[model samples]
Target chain A: MAADNDTISGYTAAFEGFEASLNGGARSPLHARRREAIAHLQEHGLPTARFEAWRHTNPAPLANGCFPPVVTAGKLSAEAIQPFVVSGIDGPLLVFADGQFVPGLSRVGDLPDGVQVHSLSAADSETAAIITANLAALALGAEHGFAALNTAFVRDGAVVTIHAGCTMDVPVQILHVSTGQAGLTTPRTLVVAAAGSRASVVETFASTTAGAGVLTSSVAEIVVGAGAVVEHARIHLHGADSLHAGTMHVTEEQDARFTAHTFCLAGRILREDVHTVLRGEHIESTLNGLSLPLGDDHVDNYTTIEHVAPDCSSHELYKGVVGGRAHNVFRGKIHVHQAAQRTDAYQSNQNLLMSDDAEINSKPQLEIYADDVKCSHGSTTGQLDPDALFYLQARGVGLQQARGVLTRAFAGELVDRLQHEGLRTHVERLVSARLDAVLADQGGAR
Target chain B: MLKITNLHATVDGTEILKGINLEVAPGEIHAIMGPNGSGKSTLAQVLAGHDAFTVTEGSVRYENEDLLDMAPEDRARKGVFLAFQYPVEIPGVNSAYFLRTGLNEVRKARGEEEIDAYDFLALIREKMALVEMDESFLKRSVNEGFSGGEKKRHEVLQMAVLEPRLAILDETDSGLDIDALRVVAHGVNQLHTPQNSAIVVTHYQRLLEYIVPDFVHVLMDGRIVRSGGKELALQLEDKGYDWIREETAAAAAATQPAGA
Candidate 1:
């Protein structure tokens, strides 16, 4: 209890200093929101194992760590971020180092009419107006500790808006690279897709080094307007010793179509929560995720799809490949309100444990108030099928190669879901390379 | 090319193959006919190096090497193949990719250069023709959602692609429609050569009519009670297995000591 209080007080003191650093912007509504968040932390403290949501995923390492906010942005070159950027997309590129946008390392091509992309920390007056109105609105009311923490320490992020009837042919890439420094970084992103607009956004969170002990708390709020189509992909490639807690809140109006893909590949301890609400009728939501956790890494994913209007549909599939002694947790909830009749929601989670010590906990919750709803969820966790392995071996494939082939196939199922050819190939190659390393470490199908 | 002496195996501590003896020479097709639980599939599985059965007492010499001492993959690399009785469904593994990987591995083990995708595709097109399989199957998952006949045909297709020295067909005709059985048997016959041998395990004489074997053996009580030419299969088909069971019983009684 004393240790917990010490950590909370540490954040409180950091917030006081953070507020003072805002200078002329200290009394702004955004800063006021930040203050409210810190006070909430002071009153609530950090979430612990006692919290039902944090039962499977422990937060002591992230909550009690000495991860002070990063005082200065890290210097990076264009070459440093070139490998992480999604190619074959002509849209704008936004690169952020230590939560601050690096303009020299980013490129914004000719924007389509009605499409605007800006850095939150250096937004124009017009962009700032939009940011101020939508910034912590969707995330904070969830009463999540990490969301609150992100709001409290938030500074620089990406702000994108697609006006009515505009369609962005290419996806916008928002790349956040950590320098593996020993400090905390908060990245906040807000995207507003107006009515009848279509856009795709890819967000990547990565580290420059493999095992740096940095802590990152990020929040992204997406407001999908009526009849809009928005596709989002969040890829995490943090270092082995880093801690990451990210939340993405999305709200869909009538006839909106939204799809989100999450790829969790690295991090010592990582948690991602994606909550979406269907506010009107005939909305469609899809969430797909894949996580490959090796070594002693821990990853937790939580998702909620709230159907508030009738005739809304949602589909979710999250798969995990756990190697070494890694652990993974997946909790998916589908809530249909009383007025949300004829809701169709489907959820499935599949996990493959490569090592005997690897573990996975998957829970699917469906709460429906309307009777005329179709909801189904299923989860399966198992090792490589011995029969399948033997069948491959009998075809003259070596045992190691057989395991590699099967494991890749299991993980590739989700990679193939990506419609973007370049991103899919990039992700596939990375996943295949990672699986190869992990399989080699396991000493070829031991 | 193969010899089994006093072969005995057990599954879960219950003996399945009891003192079975068989031999196969190159270019010969030997058909083993038997009733249910007569150790036909057991022999096939043991020869293919399935780990489910424990070889209790046996010396299996394949091309002058100890067959039991090698792993399943090693056996396969040594030109041994078994058409499975129940083909496994491997979801998410493309059939073409699986076949290519399998062929490359076999080629690698034999110190042969791996075939590139183009050449492999050409080769696969020819083999698929042998089994009358459509090109779309190459894009589908391996044996997933395949019909019973399609699965059996796929096994034969693999046999054509791998081109093993010793091919053991375990109930390859089961669950296959008449036309599918004819197509599969025809594919197997086309793949057979004077340098390779096949041990066809079956319960009926119908498949024997298509791929006529040189030798036919009747297995009962885990032992070969009778052996003859292909005409023996016809005799069993006419008289059924009851006559063989009765004859074996009488012979066993005669072997007992008088007034023991």
Candidate 2:
């Protein structure tokens, strides 16, 4: 663990300069909020490995670098974004370069009557007020440094508002590509699904070929209204050298259904946080995450589900495939409040350690204040079954390829659960290709 | 098709097979009857190249080629198959996929092009039906969640698909009931031909009734104490293994050299 002071010093200095420049421009209503958020980071600094939650994934590399914000946004054409787009979906596509939106590459066709989509800075005055009121509502500003920093610089991600009784047939895709040199980006997405409405959202984060290692700290806040259904998937496709810390916070109302899927496919250092609050009865909340880390990657996932009302249910399944010297951590907590009677929660964490040196630490905690609640949690960590491997090899599948098939099957369950067709196939191909690369690198096949 | 001479093997520093001799000609069904822990399964495993058993001193020849030199997979590719006493359940590997891969491996070793998915599906459906298995078995994980009988049937299904020249059945009828045993025996019988032979290792004579052996041998203390015609199994089943054990002991005592 690196010293927290040294970790945040570089960013703190750059942030001061950036703050001064923003002050010189026309003062905005968010100036105070941004200042307060940066002040919060200055007080707490970055979380070191000394912090229990940060024990497995050290945030030093992310905070130590002096990654100035994006300046002089690069040109993005349809050709450049074509490779990242999910084909067969004709819904809205929002493209962001380094935290700022690129109008030339974005396409928002005819939307339903009551749906509105806009970049944070470009949102109408009424939507701007809504965004401001909900900004950082899910994440407390003082607990995390990267989150506070993201809050301090939250300006140009996506703001989607679905009016009541509107159910979208197509999913909204948000693509954020970091290009040119190593820098820092803060992508803030706020989705508001009004009462009786439903929508699906997919957020993908990646880096361009010319782009060096970029450190990204992104925050997504989702609001699920009563009788609404919202499905969201966060895909991390950053380069092997990049660092990412993502946080998703959701709040569900009465009879609302919320499902969240997080894929940590690539990155040198990755950490994900998903927290959902169920405040109404008959609410169904599901959280799923699949992480495949190779080489010296460190991946961490932390999830929390708060049941504040009666008759709510939650389910969580998180799995990780760790290769080489990669290390993974999983911490899930299901807290049922006293008034949340008849709450049902199930949590399971499974890990596959492909290499001898790979490590996984999983901790599932449940705290129920109501005696009427039912909850269970279990975790398992081990290598691929030896008998299973021998069975395949005995039947003539090479040791290397056999490992590929079993590995695919281990993670394929999650891939098959993807409700979207194009996204499911895309992820399936990506995971297959990545498994091939990892197996090929093994050489001796153990 | 197969020959074993002066076979001495051990597992984990514990010797099991002291000395054994067996031979089988093409088109012959040889049954090796033995009591529990008589090294019946060890011989089958050693012949299949299982890493757990070490051949301390022995020679196994298949068509005049040393069988010990090949790996388990290489042995399979070279027309050798062993139906395990306990079929291992491999989760995440579909039964059809595993079967096709095995068949393709043998085909590839013979310099044949790999079969496509459609052909594999057709071939597996046909072979599975021969074993009395429904089509749903194709999608299941290899032996996972399958009954004991189903696993044995699955093994025979693989045999029908691979069509190995030397098939070793190691206690294949242990957990199977009468109907499953009959189905499995029938499937094995259907695949048997003049160019292929099977060595059936069993503790019960009931299995021998379905697939009558051309010859039966009683194995004791890891050695074949008596070699005879098919009536040997019936005699052992009727009179129990104690008579054979005492007879072998007396025969050994009479052959012992003076004091030294």
Candidate 3:
């Protein structure tokens, strides 16, 4: 217990170190919220195996090990980050290295009249007001240790604001590159889509090193106003040995629609928490996720969809391909409140186990308090269909290649949902390449 | 192009095919007719190198190569094709893409030039018309949500695209309507050449009217009881299979030793 306290204090000390460097914005409301967030972490400390959310994934690395905040941004050339960029996207490209904004490598020169893409640290007055008002509003600091640490440690992150009646022709790409620094980097992103607006945002987390033990605790908050449509994709392309914990909070208003696509492709230990709330009537929320974990990697996804109003609908589909001796966990909860009548919710979690030792733990829950609501949840974990495999092979495809093709099709189901051609193609390519590596590591021809 | 001698196979230790012998030559279509549970499907599966069946005692020669020793894909690459009775529905794999990959693999194995997507689309369009398949079927997942007749037609569509030397049709006419049957048979007949051969396995003689096999063999109790020209199929259709079963019993009784 004492060692745990010491590690918690280590983070507190890092917070203090960051607070001391703050000169002008220290007195701002966002900074004050940061102070309160650290105080909460100091009081509660980190969660353990006893915690419900932390039961499947062991947080000892973040609970016991001390990863001081990345004080300075790591220097990376434009060429180094080129591979992570999605080609053919005409929208602004916001780049971050080691959790700090890299303006030299970013392309923010865009005039979408009402669209704003800039760093949180360099936000304009109006943007700052929106950020301070809505940043921690959805994702509160008392949720967990990672959320608190993200609020306390983030100095620079991406802030996208879409005005009312506006539309973004191309998706805004936000790429966070880790320099493999042996520290904790907390990247914060806030997206506010005003009423009658529409846009797509793609956030990718990647590492520059093949095997670097860096911890990234990211927090993102999205506000979809009335009648707005927002599409968001979170992609993880971390190193083989990197660790990631991300939380995204989205609130949809009346008649608004929000779709979230999460692709966890790499990383040794990955945890993703997607919390969404339908705050008004006739709102729709869709959550889609795909995780391909190879080797001994561990990936856990916890999603919660809360229906706070009547006539709201939510759909969730999460798929995983577990290879090697990897482990995957998916726990989804769809809660319909008493006042929310006529609420419709559906959740499904499907996994394909590639190796004998690979394992998956899936739990889909529906807590419906309203009597007039309709809800259904199902979870299935299975191997590649032998009939499908033989059918492909009988067509002259090699055994190993047949397995690869089937596995790709399993993951490609979600990738095809991406409406953007360039992003969809890019994700397809990434998923294919990673799938090949995973199948190859399985020692082909099994 | 294909020869099987004294072939015996089993599924889960239960013998299905026992002492089967047959020979197929180029440009010839031999229809194997049998009642249910007579191992008609089992023989087709075994020839395609399906691992579920254990070939207890058999020697199958395809183009003078030991067909049993090769993997299912290897046999396919060596110009052997089996049109399954029940075509599998593979979701998320587009029909066009699946056909292209399969064709490329066959071409690569034959040391022929691989066809690009554009040319393959053109070739597939021509073949699709042979089976009356709509253009939308090409974009759908392979055989997924296809009607029973449509599945049969897709099998023939694959036969047209793959262009194998030896094609095995395992009950391809089952569950198909008259129009669909004619279309499927037309596709198979068009793909048939003097250099290629086909084995049309069916339980009914209705398909033989369209396919017009060079020879027809009646399979019963896992062995070829009788073999004759296409007229033999008509005889079975008229007299039913019980007559042949009775004849087989009579022949066995005559071969038995006198009272001992």
Candidate 4:
């Protein structure tokens, strides 16, 4: 126990060093905010195993060894990262390589009046002031050490603002790519849609390194103004040896609507935290996610939706399939405040374990303080039925193919939630590729 | 050709098939009729190598090979097929893909090259016609949401494609209607050949009218108590099973006097 305490103290000291390095830079409003966040993290230190949220996800990986901090001095070429772009979205594109803005790779066409799409460092005075007012306002706090650390070293991310009553037909794509081995990078994004504005954004993270230890900590803050509509999708397909931690914070104004989808497929250890706050009446929010992990990979998704106003609605569904020795954890919580009467919230998490050695831990919780709220939560975990397997075998299908078919069907339910045809096809291909790899590995082992 | 000699099987510590003996030669169709719990289905399951049934004492020889020693899948690879009474519903696995995989697996096990996608599609189109099944059925999940008659027809389609050396229809006609029974029987009859055999397990003789078995056997208490030609099925169907039960009891008593 004494040794454990010393190890934790060492990690805190290293984080203090990281904070000092960031504050030593020039002073801008963004820089000032980063300095303040580092000071806050220094006072709080890293979370321990005793923390309920960090119980299943141990932070020893981050604290085990030294990882050199990476910074990008100039923009990356668009031709070098063209293959990583998602096709068919016409809106302005923001590209980031190694957690720094890559202006050369971006293609921003003519935008509507009062619509701004720029890097955090390149933002003008007015835009920077708006960002300062809301940056890191919804950080996960000391309970989540990665979120705090991300805030401490946060350099350049994307910031978009749509003025009142403006509607954009195109979707803004934020592409974040990481290169090299054992490099740690944090990409931060802040989105604000003014009253009666509407927009859609797609955020994708990919790794160019084959077998590198890349740790990416990302945070995206969304504010939907009154009567505004926002649809956001976040996709994570990092390298198998990478560590990914992401948090999404959404705030809804009166009569505003927000929908977010998080898809996780490839990564070594991934922890996703989604927190949504309904601050106005008649607001709507939807949170959906699908995760497929194979071999010894592990994924954990924690989502919370808070209803702080009356007549608000929120729905969340997360599904996962685990094979080989993989493990998955899903924790979803729906909270209704004391005065949040007439709040309707539904939360569910389901998992399918393909192998006996695989494990899935799911906990769906509802904490309601209002008497008139309707909130419910449920979770289930199971494997393919033997009877179904035999039925397929008797039909002449080999055992392995039969199992793959069933597992795909189990995860297909979540893929069907994607309304966009192209996105759905892309996600389906990713899920199928993951399944094929799992099958190939098992075949090799046998 | 298939032969079963003194086959005794147990399920869950209780004996279900005690000293059962029968023989089915190629080009012949045999119908096994019995009352409920008479072990007719057990024989089909045993031949298919279902793991739940323990063959405590028996020998199942298929084409001179020891069938009892093979795995269920191995039995399939060796040309033995069982049409389940309750076909399992496997969602997410398309019917066409399932059949193609099964066909290619058996082909590969026999040291033959696999069929390409174009050839597979052609083969499936030819086989689907035997049961009057639509091409659209190939896109749906295997047996998922399929009606009882459709599932039975699907089974026949599989049997038609695999062309097993010995096929066991385990109460395949139980839930099917008259028309479905005729279609299923027609599909089975079309596959009959001097190199192939079939065993039809049914509780009613109605299915026999279409299949027209070469030999009919009555199974009771886990053993065959009577054997005759196709006419016996009609007799049993008209008179019911009570008379056969009484005759079997009297015959047993006569064979061993009062004190033996």
Candidate 5:
């Protein structure tokens, strides 16, 4: 039964069909890498909940044929994707529908000098060779099944490269929409921040219909050059029945700075893996996440920060609010190598369970091999205080509004931490909308 | 006015108020004095509709309606209030915003329009003086990181703003120094009127000196053993609760039904 249920067989078949359609040798090494990824999936099926890292998120629905793979994307009108655009960005907005770039629907303004921003599928021969050289360089192995699969089927995604000492004043947004065909959307991104350059990128994912189920497998690889600064934010608002799993691999050179903010509000099953390597001295990395799940949905966040050089620092905080029967999982790991002395790392995860059936599991771990390193990790999970609720109720605020006040307060901490005003406001609005949806669901259930 | 008849309440299945009865008319300040573990705070909590305490047998009537049947928020809307012994700390909720929400909700319940931010600012600024609270307190989180005295004063501030008809102050003076006691008591005195009544629950005589009670009742072992006029407080302060306990016990034993 297990062998029969092996879902990768379906994907293997799809790969053969896809390979036959592509121009021979026109794809070159990327096509070769694609073949290798699908072959691994055939040998070893998709990851199960039994895996230590996949303990909380179960991809069984996809494997069991509940959500089959999508070989072709559905045709969606421009009206379907008008809602997911990030309104504050003026430079460039790359639009993708089920892993295929839609240029007619996208809007690209004038960009700064020495900044190259375009879709990977639109890469020229010389640019394609450069991308092929760097492709799979950051995400190397098939151990991460979703990332490998994403690589195998990556049709189009944002590819950005900034010249040395250049800075972009405006943000570049990459918007991906899964139009609810019960299929798959794989969008792979690569960003190279040249030395002494500064840039910011925002990625958003969502589906058109409210409860339509789909599978989205995405991977993003980033390289921060020496003395460069890069800020990245990923906001996922997939439908409640969809499954979203993405991996991010970032490597920082000496004296570079990198900050990543992840916001997940919708999805039946959502999991994010973030890995950052501090390779040189004076490198700093920040990872912040906010997740609010409703009903029986599940949201999982896993982050790992490895310090490979002396005088490096990392700070991470992940907060969650689980309403109804939702479940939330967060695990953060900080590893300091033997030669990475003077390393400073701190991690904290706080969660609030809004209903009796809600569940939150948090684990913060530190593995330090250096004697002079300072590593601290803490995790807390608790329900909203009854006393606080009563205090509000006693003053004439109704029970429901009081609950909303407390819930908003719990999410406000994360919303306020966003240093970018536009991003903060955008995220705050999403939080409010999410809370309203949760309240509506609860009201209906009650 | 408020009336309690044959009141019996419990916490965690343990009886706390055993067949206690009390009444307060308009313009009256009734004091409930008892030693530790005498259920003084429990009574205050029960009157305010705290769900932790179960009313095994009792009826509480206010304005000729059954007060015990109402929810906590409903009771608040009906002009019933309790100044908590330890005011809860709710972080990230601005004090001014919370206060306005409370006032506006009560107004909405009474068919009154909500107060605008401009009017609310002026109203809260005027009420802040009653409790001797700084204008800065209005911007901070509700009672978060507040000093003990500030929390108590904030309660008085709420009472002043809500203008409850039946206010129950539970241990409001337990942790206050003399100056804070005077400020809080002064605020209470300023808000008192012939149209409203109050029930003051305390352990010491110092608070009674400022907010004088019209009647004093002594509670022991979950029952009110004695009731009297204002002199009762002075007498209890000098003699303590032992004499009252002994007198009640003797009377109970002497009146015991003929058994065996």
Candidate 6:
């Protein structure tokens, strides 16, 4: 037992050391926050399987390892970032490689009046003040250890603020590319759409190689002020051997509208936790997610929508497909506070298991304290219907092609929900490639 | 083109098809008429290689090939089509895409080059006209939310497109109205060639009148007890299956002594 205790303490100390190296001697108020966060994490320590959010998704792989902090050696070229740009959106671009900001690869053209796009490290005094005021306001008491660790190691993340009543014509794209020598990388982001302001933002995380054993911990904070409409999308396309842990914290004020789409593909083990708080009345939030995990990959999505005020509405839908020995977990909770009368909340999670050995765990929960609220939650997990398969086969389609048709249909439902045509099509192509890989493996097995 | 001898099948330990025999030749349309639970649908499913039915005894031959030994898809590739009584709804697969996949797969299995998209579109358009199906049917998901008539028409469209050597219409006219039945039968008739054949499995003779079968077989207790030239279907329609059941029992008693 003493040996076990010493090994655990040693791992925690190594994690602390890793957090300190992310600062890299950078001097700023954000760095001060990082110092405070590290101390806080040290006191609380990493969460274990006892935590409800971390129960089904074990973090032992992350907690027990030693990883070096990644730093930007140089700016990634434009050509390297062009393929990731969301089509049909012309706005300022910010690029990050290996968790560090690269200004040379970014484009900050003439922006609309009262709109600012700058990194936390390069922000002026007033801008920094604005960021400091709301940087980690919504990330309080993050029970999940990875979120707390990301908060503590916050180095260079985007800080966008749109002034009241300002409307940006184009969305801002923040592309984070991980190019490292097989190790862990933690990326952080903070976005704010002020009162009565409207904007769209797209965040993308991708890897350059098939480096195994890589880890990426990301945190995105979104603040939708009163009467504001903000659309945010996050895409995760890491290497097959990479582990991803991401948290999205959203706070919606009165009469605010917030919409988010999360796409997770090609990760070894991924756990995404999304928490949205309706702070004021008449606020609306929509959350949509799609994930595909193949081979020995494991993907978990945990989301919580809290209704703290009266007359708020929220809708959530998440779908997943798992093949091979892959395992997927979906846990969604919608909580309605006593003061939140007339709250309307809905959530659903659907999963398809392609192989007998593949597994999926889904739990949709609703806790309501208000009497006048409407809330509903549903979840389903099942294998392909043999009758449906035979029906397609009788039409002359081979067994493999029939399976592909059904699997694509399962993915097409979520793809149709994407608002952007180009992104939808692009994601569909990725889904196709993933299915092709599954079929190829099946062929190899035979 | 098709032959079944002493066909015996079971489901869930219960025998459904027992010692059934039938034969179909090229350019001929045969109707198997029977009451509910008379194994009408079982014969179609067994011939199409449905996994639910276990062929405990006997054999099925299509074009002199051992049909029972082939996979369901292989049977389809060998030009055997089963128009489902209850068409399965594939929610995400478009009708056009599903048909094209089926067509190309069959062509490839036959050592033929796959048809290009343009040629496929043209072929589908021509078949869709035979059923009077709307152009939007091609874009909609397969059989999902389709009306009874539309699903039947879609089935006929598949038959016309595949041009199978032997097609089995399994209660294809169950839910269709008069006009839809005419369209379905017209599509089947137009696809009939000297080298192709059909087996219409139906409960009523109304569909047989439209499709015009050359022969009729009365199936009861999983065997063909009576065979005639189209008049058997009309007799079963007019006098009902009770008369045939009585005659079958009497004939069996006469052939096999009670104490043997």
Q: Which runs in model 5 stand beyond 4 Å of their true positions?
A: A1-9, A24-45, A63-73, A88-91, A112-116, A123-135, A163-171, A195-197, A210-213, A226-229, A254-257, A355-357, A439-446, B253-260
> Each model's fnat?
0.69, 0.52, 0.65, 0.48, 0.70, 0.83
Winner on DockQ between 1 and 6 is: 1
Order of candidate numbers by TM-score, starting with the best: 3, 1, 2, 6, 5, 4
Winner on lDDT between 2 and 4 is 2
- lDDT by residue (tens digit), candidate 3, B223-250: 9999999999999999999999999999
lDDT of 4 by residue, B115-186 (tens): 899998898898888899999999998898999999999999999988898899999999889999999999
lDDT, each prediction: 0.89, 0.84, 0.90, 0.82, 0.85, 0.82
Give me candidate 2's TM-score against the actual structure: 0.93
Superior candidate under TM-score, 3 versus 5: 3
Tens digits of lDDT, candidate 4, A148-257: 66776777899999989997656788988887446568888889999999888878887776436677888899999999999888888788888887878888999998
Better of 3 and 6 by DockQ: 3
TM-scores of the models, in the given order? 0.97, 0.93, 0.98, 0.83, 0.90, 0.91
State the lDDT of candidate 6 residue by residue for A364-433, as single tens digits. 8889999999998888888677899999889787788788888889878877876666667766786688
Give the TM-score comparing model 4 with the true structure, all chains together. 0.83
- Residue A227 lDDT in candidate 4: 96
Q: Say what the RMSD of model 3 is.
A: 1.7
Instruction: Chain B TM-score per candidate, please.
Output: 0.98, 0.97, 0.99, 0.98, 0.98, 0.97
Docking class of 1: medium
The model with the greater DockQ, 1 or 5, is: 1
Q: Give one digit per residue, the lDDT tens place, for model 5 in A103-200.
A: 88887777888788889878767557667766768645534888877877877788888888999767788888887777777878888888999999
Displacement of the residue A17 alpha carbon in candidate 3, Å: 1.8
Write the residue-wise lDDT of candidate 5 on B1-260 in tens digits: 78899999999999999998998899999999999999999999998888899999989999999999988898898898899999999888889988999999889888899999999889888899878899999889999999999999999999988888888999999899999999999988998999889999999988999999999999888888899988999999999989998898899898988793
Tell me the lDDT of model 5 at A51. 70
Q: Would you list the clashing residue pairs of candidate 5?
A: none
Clashing pairs in 2: none
Residues A1-446, model 1: lDDT tens digits: 88878887888888889888888888888888898888777778777878877778988888884578887887788777877887677779999998988898888879999999999877888788888889888635434878888888888889999999999868889998898777889988899999999999899998887636688999999999999999999989898788998999999999999999999987889999899999999999999999888888899998999999999999999999888888899999999999999999999999998888788999998999999999999999998998899999899988898999899999898899887888888788878887886665442232
lDDT of 3 by residue, A1-446 (tens): 88778888888788777887897768989898898788878887777777888778888865677788888888889888888899888789999999999888988875588899989988999998899789888536344778888888888899999999899869899999998888899988999999999989999999889636689999999999999999999999998999888999999999999999999999999999989989999998999999999888899999999999999999999999988888899999999999899998999999998888788899887888999998998889998888888888889999998998899888999999998999999999999999987776552232
